[model samples]
Target: MSEQDLFADIRPYNDNEVAPAIQRLIADEEFIQAILHYRFPHMPGVIGSVAAPLLRFILKRKLAKLKSVQDVQRQVATFMNKMIETTSKEITFSGLELLDPKKSYLFLSNHRDIAMDPALVNWCLHQKGFATVRIAIGDNLLRKPCATELMKLNKSFIVKRGAKGPREMLKNFSQLSAYIKHSLDENHSVWIAQKEGRAKDGNDVTDPAILKMFYMQGKKQGTDFATYMAELNIVPVCLSYEYDPCDTDKIKELWQKKTVGHYQKSEFEDIDTIIKGIVGFKGRIHVAFSAPVTSIPAEPDDLAKLIDQQIWQNYRLFPINYLAAGIQDSSIDEVAVEQWQNRLMAVPDGAHDLLTQLYAAPVAKKQ
Candidate 1:
């Protein structure tokens, strides 16, 4: 559904809630063609030659008309193949056979590089015979050109900005929670960042707000948090970037945020950063997958803490990030700092500078 119709359907929604007559208009071939053309004015062969025709054929003639997950799996795999080519990575994934290909999962992950984080998870899921997961992407990035087009195609729905209006923001999250539950019920997975935005540096942390939102998803449904988490199959994913292409820009922004209380990206600048993050080479990057959250207390606060700890444990912090943080400030025990320095010294000289950038922000907070 488009952002407009989503606001209208604020109440409960079922699989058939998004009937073709209305939602189809939103996904109409003519409209998609126009958007694809607009976004890729210079590059049409991939979108027009393959994507446009295939998507139109499916949405128009095959969507609800088909019932098998096999069909969905095929489409998702092809889309991922394209994604692999588009993002250009030495993409390696583990924990491959743990999940049932057809069962749904709540894929919670650390937000490392922009754009690529969701894309990588989607790509891996596709390769493993799962349908593309619905994504939770913020409206701030959706305001731009490249980011907006890419995210939508990748199955992300909009999340309203804070300044939009307090009511509007909550309304957006409510819709998100509903949609996520719906996707899970339909045996389709959903991917969301642990935090709101991109990870500026290699160190990834879980945002308490994200856990709070997951708790909110099942609260009003008369379902307790543990039952909700168990049913949803919350799977944590860790994405490690050996080198952050946006390190300089992130440091610059970090400087601003530290010097002043605020910082904003120039129009389309975030897009540039995302592109660099995706294409950037991350050496010896690792993705650690945790078993799904099977057991938990019903209390929201307790559940939140459990989720936070799980996320932190999977966070793929490279040696550089640890070294940078450990060394950049001497107040944090010099002995411990020397340990990170020793570890950094051990990481091959070729990757030293990249590691330094990923870790050493020289700002109020470690990126």
Candidate 2:
């Protein structure tokens, strides 16, 4: 099969495919109910059910003009602008001006919030007149059909997280590797988390397995590891949130895993986390774009360390971090101290220390 055909199952919706995907979303009853629940959370279930048709009608009309991927993104940008204005105190970026807008990059970002990390990165690129990236989302988050459609419409490609066997896992990883290289070759950038899931405990460590996955296609093509890595233009991105919206949830999960030895996630927990990440208040946010990797390390472990160093060094430390780490710096004001204390009080006593350590992890890592 041709490369395009091979990646068809995983690639984002192209221009011609956008309309059909939008239609599918509009026609989906569950998608309409989700919108109603989000927009009118206090409404009775019966009332929401009754209003679903009207919601669908409104969506169909509002989305009818979105005939291409760019059109969908422009609509998403409007929502993003509103989200940033309301949810965040301020959003800032550094090192973006140094990069060439014409070149494509593989942005290896430290994941915190499930949705906001990539959304903020795309927003930064969009505001700076750079083309937004093709986001790499795991299939675990795409269990809902509505989600899959919405994500693909927003230029997100799937990463097969549910490969059943070793052979299937290898096949999926190889295809994913090929897809990233393919995207860069087509002058389209890609954004992927450094690890498999969000670093709920505030650590931003790059997994060497991810780096090795990037090398799979290179290995198949007989390209040396260093050369292939350099060719991919991998850039490390750091996303720092002053107050993580889902901090309490993360702390509870950590506490459970430590005390209970295991924690189970509900069926829709990821979806709930994504919603919370979007609408919840994030005090201040910063995105740091590091210089693309020029001198590539031959080993995945070494490359992981290099990426980790860039993320840690360039991370925009906030007052909350200092407060959590018990570092009495000038940046930690009375207000920040109160906020940190309030957050601690909000969680259970047993998890309070975990919450402190969660916010303090970055401070510790940097030191």
Candidate 3:
């Protein structure tokens, strides 16, 4: 069987399918609506109705000639550049030189925003002249077929979330492990979250199950666990956002989960969060790529803790984070704390403490 056949159900869209996927995405009404709203946010009345079709035509014409993933990435970089320039005061990087453009590594980053975490990492890689990584996206986000097609076009593979039964779950994890190994062997880098979902409360924790999944195929092949992990060249990435666009929303969700023991997301909640994360102001953003973990611990939980430590240690603590911790911390300047407090004056009464928790949790955990 062909190597590609192993990942047929979960692999990204190939070059041959790029044009068709773009066509399908442009033709999708939901996609059109989203573009219309995003491009013409203030003018959603007659102006939007008249401009949407023309904008769609222009976009289709521009995208029609793109033949490869790199072409799409070049186009994506345009928007990323603009967003960074306008939304962020400065974007910084650390340990990027550790990455070799000629080699492939599995990057496991702490998830924050629904989209921008991986997108920011991709933008950095692109800027550094490295080949973009194949992202692991949960199937839950692809409820819209157009969304799935678009993500696949950008070299994102499905993670088969919501699997039923232990056997099915194990099968899914096995396939996922095999795909990661295959991608790296084929010289394609892979990016996955350290955990299954975004850490909404600002505490970034690695799930041991994710680490165990990485060892599934290697264990089956009778390879030593530590050697297999080293072969994968696993790297931990820390993504820090000075001002999370969905800070309040995440805080509310976290609070609800803590108080009610569960929280149900709205149908379009992820979509809304994704949009906000992209277009919202991030202040100063930093992505740190740690050295590859060559000496993996024997236990998955130990490995998870090691990753967590790397992420926490490398995480950039912004002034807002310090302010969120409290005025007595003395780590942050009084002026900066006052500035953040003034900004929070506009936040609703109930959300203020939750928002503080969202930013302060990281600082508290690091301490």
lDDT order, best first, reads 2, 3, 1
Clashing pairs in 3: none
lDDT preference between candidates 2 and 3, better one: 2
Regions more than 4 Å wrong, model 1: 1-89, 144-149, 201-203, 315-367
Better of 1 and 3 by lDDT: 3
- Candidate 3 lDDT by residue in tens digits, 231-309: 9999999999888887767777766776789999899888888888988888889999999987799888989998899
**Clash pairs, model 2 backbone:** none
Model 2 local distance difference test score: 0.93
What digit string (tens of lDDT, one per residue) describes model 1 on residues 240-286? 65455555566566556666879986876765676567555444455
Q: Candidate 3, after superposition: displacement of residue 312 in Å?
A: 1.2
TM-score, prediction 3:
0.92
Query: Which 10-residue window of candidate 1 scores lowest in summed lDDT?
Result: 9-18
Quote the lDDT for 80 in model 1: 54
lDDT tens digits, residue span 1-367, model 2: 8989999999999999999999999998889888888888899988877798888888888999999999989999999999999999999999898799999999999999889999999999999999999999999999989999999999999999898899999999999999999999999999999999989878789999999999999999999999999999999999999999999999888889999999999998999999999999999999999999998888999999999999998878899999888888888888898999889998889888889888999888887
Q: Which scores higher on lDDT, 1 or 2? A: 2
TM-score of every candidate: 0.66, 0.98, 0.92
Residue 319 in model 3: lDDT: 80
